[model samples]
Target: MSIRRAAIWSFASQYASFVIQFATSVIISRYYLLPADVGLFSIALAAAMVVAIFQDMGISRFVTGQPEMREEHLRDYAAVAVGLGWGIAALVAAGAVPLARFYGEAGLAKVMLIIAGSYALFPFSIVPSAMLTRALDFRRLFQANAGSALAGAVVAIATAANGAGPAALAWGMVAATLARLILVMAAYPVLPRRPASLEIVKPMLGFGGSSFVISLSGAVGMRCQDLIVGRMLGVSATGLFTRASALAGQLTTLMVGAINSVFYPAFAKKRDAGEDLAAPYLHLIACNTGITWAAAIGLALAAEPVVHLLYGPNWADVAPLLRWTALAELFFVAMPLQMDVPILLGRIKPLVWINLLDTFITVVILVVASFWGLEAAAIGRILTGAIWLAIYASYIPRLVGIRYSALGTAYLKSAAVALAAGAPLALSRWMSGAGAEMGFISLLGLSLAGVFCWLVALPLVRHPFWQELRLALSHMAKLRTTQA
Candidate 1:
C-alpha cells in the first residue's frame, strides 16, 4: 500500500488497459467504418474533453495533495465536486446546439450533449478514486481500469460490427466510464455521505484554484491542435492527426500518471513536514526521462509497420504523424516532475501562469499552422511540446534548487540514445524497399529489424541506466534473500 507499490500496480493496469484499447481501435477502425467516421468521432471526443475540463477544478488533486485527509473532508469535497460537475455539464449541454451550429454540424450537438452530460456522473466518482490513490491502494485502480477496458472494448466491437460507426465510439467511451465508476465504487469503502454545503466548498476551491487554471489552460492547449485541424483542414484530417496523437498521448499519460499518482502524495507529505526532499525528486526525473526516451525511440523506429499492422492500410497515412507526435512524448513524460512537483510544493501561482503562457502560445501556433494543413499542424504540436519542455527545464531548477547541469546532462544522453536507436530503424526501412508492400511478412520482418537494432544499440550509449538496472536487480535479489 506504499506509494511505490501503488505506482507499480497503476503502471501494470495502464499497460493492460492500453493493450485492450489499442486492439479495439484497430478492429473498429479497420473492419467497421470509413476513415471519415473515425474523424467525426475524434471531433466528438475532443468536444467531450473540452467540456470535461470545466467539471471540477481539480478538487481531487487538492484532496490527494493533502497531508492528512479525513472522511468528513472527503464527503465535503465530493459534494462540491459533484455540484460543480453537474452545473458545468448542464451549462455545456444547454449550449450544445449553438456550439454545434457555429461549427456547422448540427448533428454534433446531440453527441456533445451525451458526452458532456457524463461530466455530471464523473465528479461523483472522484472522491472515492482520490481516497484510494491517497491510501496508495492502486490494486483497486488496476482492477477497475483493466475490467473497464475489457468490457468497453467488447461493447465497442459489438456496436462497430453492427455498423453503428461513430455511435459505436460514443457507446464504447460511455461503457468504459461507467465500468470504471462501478468498479471504483465497489472497491472503495467510503462513500460521499453529505449534501452540498458552502463550508466543504471553500477550502477545496481555495487549495485547487490555481490547479483549476492550470488544468483549464492545459486542456485548451492540448486540444488546440484538434480545434485548429477540425476548423481548417476538415474533420477527416483532424481525425487522422487526433488518432495518431492519441496513441502517443496514451504512452505519455501512462508514464506521467504513474509517477504523478505516487510522487504528488509523497511530495506533499514531505513538504508539509518541512523535509528536505531533493533525492526522491531527482530520482523521479531520471527514471521518467530514461523510460520515455526508450519508448519514443522504439516507437519512432517501428512507426510504419506498427501503423500498418495496428490500424490497417487506410490508416497508413497516420504513420508519419504518429512518428512526429511520439517525440513529444519524450518531453511530456517529464511533466510530472516539472509541473506536479511545483504544485505539491505550493508554488501554484507560478504553475498557473506558466500554463497560461503555454496555452497562449499553443493557440497561436495551432491556428497559424492549420492554414498549412495536417502535416504542418502535426509539426506544430511537436514544436509546442518542445518549447514548453524548454521553458520548464529552464525555470524549474532555480525554483527547486536542483543542479540543472546534472538534469541537462541526463536529458542530453537520453536524447542521444533515442536518436541512435531510431536512426538505424529509419535507415533499415528505407533500404528495405521503403516499406511499400504493407503485407504481414513485410511488417513482421520490419518489426524484427527494429527490435534487433534497438536492443543492439541501447546498452552502448549510457552505462548509468544499465547501472540503475543492475542496482534494481541487486535490490530484488537482496529482498528475496531476506525472505528466504
Candidate 2:
C-alpha cells in the first residue's frame, strides 16, 4: 500500500483515539477526579510503564526493520515478547506495594496493581500489531485501535462515575489493552505456541539489546517526570503538571503520532529500495515543523482560555505549564525521525548514546527545576528541548547523509512558516491581554486568523510546505468530485 493510504488509515485510527481519550479525560478531570487523584495514578502508572518498556523490547522495530519476515522469525519474535511481557507483569505486580510505600500513598499500590493487569495482554497485541504495520495494513490497525479506544473510554467514564477514583483510569487501560489484543488477533490470527530455540533468541539479542536500551532510556525520560515531580513537589503539583502536559501532549500527539507510527517502516522500505533518504527526511522536517510548530504556538497562546473552557476554573493553573509544554513540542518535531533514520542506517550505536544523553538531560534538568516550583520545572523543559535539538542535530544528519547547510536551510523555511502562522495569534494575544479576557470564542477566531495568515504566507515564503498543503487539498477535492 502507498504511504498516503497507510497514513490515512493511521490518522483515522489516531483521530478516533484522540477524540475518545480527550473526551474521557475532560469528563474525569472536570467532574470526577482531582489533580492529586490523578497524580496518585500518574506516579504508579509511570513506574509500571517504565518497567513495561520491556514488553516490546524493540520487537516492533525488529519486525518492521526486517527485510523479509519469514513465519519462523515471527514465531521467534512472539516468543521473546511473551516471556518479557509476562515477566514484566509479574514484576509490576510484585513491586506495587513497595513502590506505593516508597511514595507513601496506599492508593499508588492499588493503581499499579490494576495497571499490571494490562501487561498480561501485552505480548498478544505487540506482534500482531507489528505484523500489521510491517504489511502497511493500517486498515486493520484502524479497526483494532478504534475499538480499543472506545472500550477504554467507556470503562474509564463508567468506573469514574462509580467512585473508583484514580483506579478507574488504570481499569480503562486494562480494558483498552484487552480489546486491542482481541481485535488485533482477529485481524491477524496467528501466534507462536511457545518459546523459540536458544539459537533463534541469540541472533535477535544484538538488535533487541540495543533497542531495549534505547527504549528503556526513552521511557525513563518520558515517564520519569511524574515520579520525579511527585517526589519533589508533592502529588498535587505533579497532578497539575501532568494535567497540563496531557492536554499539550495530546494536541501534539494528534498531529504527529500517526506519522510516527508509519515512518519507521516507511523509512526502512525506502532504504531497502536504495532510495536517497535525505530528501524525504528533509521534506518530513519541512512538513512536520510547519504544521506542528504553528499548532504548538497556537496552543501555547490559547492555553488560558483552553484550560478554562475544557476543564473549568479548577484547572486554570494548567495554563502556564501548557504554554511551556506546547512550546517544548516544537523541539521534538524540529528533528523528525531522530531515531528511525539512524536505526535504518545501521547507526544504532550512536543512537543509543544519543538516547542516553537525552534521558540524562531530561532527568537532571527536571529534577533541579522541580526544586524551584512546578512552572519552573516546565521552563526547564525548554532548556532540555534546546539541548535535545543540539544533541540530535549533531549526529542524525550525518547518519542520513544530509549536509548541515541543507538541514539548516530546511529549518529556516519551516521557521519562517511557523512565524507567519503564529504572528496573527501572537498579535491578537498581545492586544487582547490574557486568553481568558479574549474568551474561548475570540481565541478561536484569533486561531482562525492565524490559519488564514499561514495559508497566505506559505506561497509568499515559497516554502515546500505550500506545495504539500496544495497537494492534500487537491487530493481531498478529487475524492469529493469523484463521489459527486
Candidate 3:
C-alpha cells in the first residue's frame, strides 16, 4: 500500500479510538470521579508506564526497521518480549505498594496492581502488531485497535457508573490490553515458539538495548511531572495537570501521531532501498507543522469552551493549563520525526545521548518549578521542549543532510499559515470581548472560520504542505472510486 493509504487507515483507527476514549474520560470526570480520583489513577499509570517501557525492549521497532526480517527472527524476538513482559509485570506488582506509599496514596497501589495484569497480555500482541505494521497492513491493525478501545471504553464507563473510582480506569486498561491481544492474535496468529538459537538474540539486543535506554529516559521525562505533582502538591494538582496534558496531547495524537506511526516504517523502507531522505524529510516536517500548528493554536484559543463542553465546569481550571500545554505541543509537533530519523539511519547512540540530555533538563526544570505550583511546572515543560527542539535542529541537519535554511523555511511558512488560520478567531474574541465567557455556538463558529481561513491560506503560503494535502485528497478520491 502507499504511504498515504497507510496513513489514512492509521488516522481512521486513532480518531475512532480517541473518540471512544475521550468520551469515556469525559463521562468519568464529569459525573463519576473527582479530580483527586483521576490524579491517583494518573500517578499509578505514570509509574506503570515507566516500567512498561521495558516490556517491548524495543523489539517492535527492531522488527519493523530490520532490513532483513525472518520467521526465525520474529520468533526469537517474541520469546524475548514474553520474558520481558512477564518480568515487568512482576516488578510492577512487587513495587506497587512502595510506589503508592511514596505518593501517600493507598488507592494508587490497587490501581498499579490492576494495571500490571495488562503487561502480561502485552507480549501476546506485540510481535503480531509489529508484523502488521512492518507489512503496512494498517487495516487489520485498525480493527484490533478500534475493537480494543471500544471494549475498554465500555468497561471503564460501566465501572465508573457503578462507583468503582480509580480502579475502574485500571480495569479498563486491562480489558483493552486483553481485547487487543485477542484481536491481533486472531488477525495474525503467529505465536512465539522455542527459540532455535541464541545467535539471533545478540543483534536484536544490541539494537534494542540502545532503543530501550532512549525510551526509558524519554518515559522518565514525560512522567516525571505526574510524580512531582502527586508528591509535592497533591492528587488534586496532579489531576488538573493530567487533565490538561491529556487534552493537549489528544489534539496532537489526533493530528500528528497517526501519520508518525506510519513514517518510521516508511522511513525504514526508504533507507533500506538506498533512497535520498532529505527532500522527504523536509516535506514531512512541513506537512506536520502546517497541520499540527494550526490545530494546537486553535485548541489553545478555544480551550475555554472546549474544556467546558468536554469536561464540564468543574474542570474550568484546566483551560489555562491546557493552553500552555498546547504551546509545548507546538514545539513537539514541529519536529515529529526528529529522533526517528537518526534511529532509522542507525545513529542510535547520539539519539540516546540526546534523550538523556533532554531528560536531565526536563527533570531539573520540572523539579525546581514544582516548588511554585502546577502552572510553573507546565511553563517549565514549554521551556524544556523549546530547548530540546533547538538541540534537535542543531543535529538533524547534519544527520539528514537537510540544511538549516530549508528547515527554517518550512517552519516559518507553517507558522505563517497557522497565524493566518487563527486570525479570524482572535479578531472575533477581541471584538466580542467575551473571552472565556463565549458560548459553545460562538466558539464553534470561530473554530470553523479558522479552519476555512487555514484552507484558504495554505496555497498563499507557498508551502509544499498544500501540494501534499492535494495529493492526500486525490488519493482518497481514487480509493473511493476503486471501492465503488
Candidate 4:
C-alpha cells in the first residue's frame, strides 16, 4: 500500500479507538466507578503495562529486519512471544497479592491478577499485528484494533450496567483482547502451528532483549506514578488522576502515536536500505513537533470545557490537573521522535541511560508529590518532561550528526509561533469570567477574536509562521490555478 493509505488507515483506527474510549470514560467515570474503584482499576492497568514491557521483547522490530522472512520465522517468533508473555503474566499474577497488600487494598490483588491474565491473550495477537505493520497492511490491523476497542467498550458498558464496577474495566480489556485476537487471526490466512528452528533466535533475542529493558524502564518511568498515587492518595484520587491523564494521553496517542506508527515502518525501511537519514529525520521532527505542539496546546486550552462537557461537573477537579498535564505533554511530543530514532538506527543504548535517569526523577517526583499532594505529582510530571527535553537536546544531534544549534532553532521557531498564537487565548480567558455561559454567541466571539489576533499578529510578529501561512495559501492558490 502507499504511505498515505497506511497513514489514513492508522488515523482511522486511532479515531475508532478514541470514540469508544471517550464515551466509556465519560460514562464510567461519572456513573459507574467510584473514585477508589477508578484508582484500583488504574493501578491494575498500570501493573499490566509494566509486565508488557518485558513481554513485548521487541520482536516487532526484529521481524521487520528479516527481508525474506518465511512462515517458519513467523512461527518461531510466535512461540517466543507466547513463552515470554506467559512468563511475565505469571510473575505479575504471583505478585498481585503483595502489590495489593502494599497498597492497602485487599481486592487490588485479584484485580491485578485478572488484568495480568489478559497478557497471555496479547501474544496471540502480537506477531500478527507486527507482521501486518511490517507488510504495511494497516487495513487488517485497523480492523483488529477497531473491533477490539468497540467490543471492549460494549462489554464495559454492559457489565457496568450489571453493577460490576471496576471489575467491568478489567473485563473490558479481556473482552477487547479476545475480540482483537479473533479479528486479527481471521484477517490473516495462516494459522499458528509448531515452532521453527532456533536459528533466528539469537539475533531476535539480541535486538529484542535491549528493547525489553527499554520497555520495562520506560513503563516504570511512565506508570510508576499510578502505583504510587494509588497507594498514597487511595483509589478514588488515583482514579480521577488516571482518568485525567488518560484523556490527555488520548490526544497525544492519537496524534503522536499515529505518526510514530507510520514513522517506524517508513523510516525503518529507509534505515535498512542505507538511505540518507538526515532528510527523513529532520522532516519527521518538524512534522512531529508542529502537530504535537498544536494538539497539546489546543487540548490544554480546551481541557476545562472538554471535561465539563464530556465528564460533567462531578469531575471538576480533573480540569486543572488535565490542563497542567497536557502542557507537560508539549515537551513529550518530541519524545517519540527521540525514541524511534535510536530503535530504528539500532542505537538504543542512550535510551537505557536516559530512561534510567527519567525513572529516578519520575519516582522522586511522584513520591514527593504523594507527600504534598496530587498537584505536586502533576508538577513532577512537567519536570519529567523537561528532563526528556533536555536529554533530547544533547542526544538527537549526536545520533544524527546534526548540530545542536540547528535543532534548537527548529524547536524555538515552533515554540515562538505557538506562543504567539496562544498568548491571546490566555488573555481572553483571564478577562472572561468562568460564570459566563459558553453559548454559541460566546464561542463565536472567542473564535473570531482568536482568529483575528492570530491573523493580524502572526503576519507582523512571527515571520516564520507568516512564511508557512503564505506557503500553505500559495499551494491552495496553485491548486486553484491548476483547476482554472
Give candidate 4 regions above 4 Å deviation: 65-68, 189-196, 420-424, 435-484
Error of 1 at 460 (Å): 5.2
Order of quality (lDDT): 3, 2, 4, 1
lDDT of model number 4:
0.75
- Residue pairs in collision within model 3: none
Put down candidate 4 lDDT per residue, 1-484, tens digits, no spaces: 8765687688788888888878887888778777678788889888778867877788877776554567666777777888888888898888888887787788788777778768878887778888888888888888988889999999998998898878888889989988998998887633445565556577788888787888788799888778888878777788778877887788888765766787778877777787876656665565566555665775676667667766667777787788889888888876456766777776788777776786787788779877888777776778878887887767776777766666666676556545645655566677874422355455545545655655665555443445545776786798899999
Q: Which candidate model has the greater TM-score, 3 or 4?
A: 3
Q: Against the true structure, what is every candidate's RMSD?
A: 2.7, 1.3, 1.3, 3.5
Give the Å shift of residue 213 in candidate 2. Answer: 0.8
Q: Per-residue CA lDDT of candidate 2, range 1-484, in tens?
A: 8998898899899999999999999999999998899999999989998998888887888877877777666776787888889999999999999998898998988898889898888788788888899999999999999999999999999999999999999999999999999999999865866654676767566788898999999999999999999999889888899988888788777987888788788988988999998888877777788778888988887888888888888787889999999999889888877887887788888889889999999999999998889999999989999999999988887778789998888778777777877887788767756666567677777788889988887788777778877887999999999999
Estimate the lDDT of model 1. Answer: 0.74
What TM-score goes with each of the models? 0.91, 0.97, 0.97, 0.89
Greater TM-score among 2 and 4 belongs to 2
Off by over 4 Å in 2: none
TM-score of 3: 0.97
Residues 1-484 of candidate 1 have per-residue lDDT tens digits of: 7665667787788788888988898888888876677777677667667666767687778777777666766777776777778887787678778767766876667666766655666776788888877777889989988998998899899988997777787777778878888998898744555656666667777877777788888888876567667778877787798878988887776655566567777777778888876666766776676666766766765677778777778888888888888877777676456667777777889888887888898899888877887878777777888888878877777777778777776677666655655665567666864553446675566556654554555477662455556765787899999999
Candidate 2 weakest ten by summed lDDT = 194-203
- Assess candidate 1 and give its TM-score to the true structure: 0.91
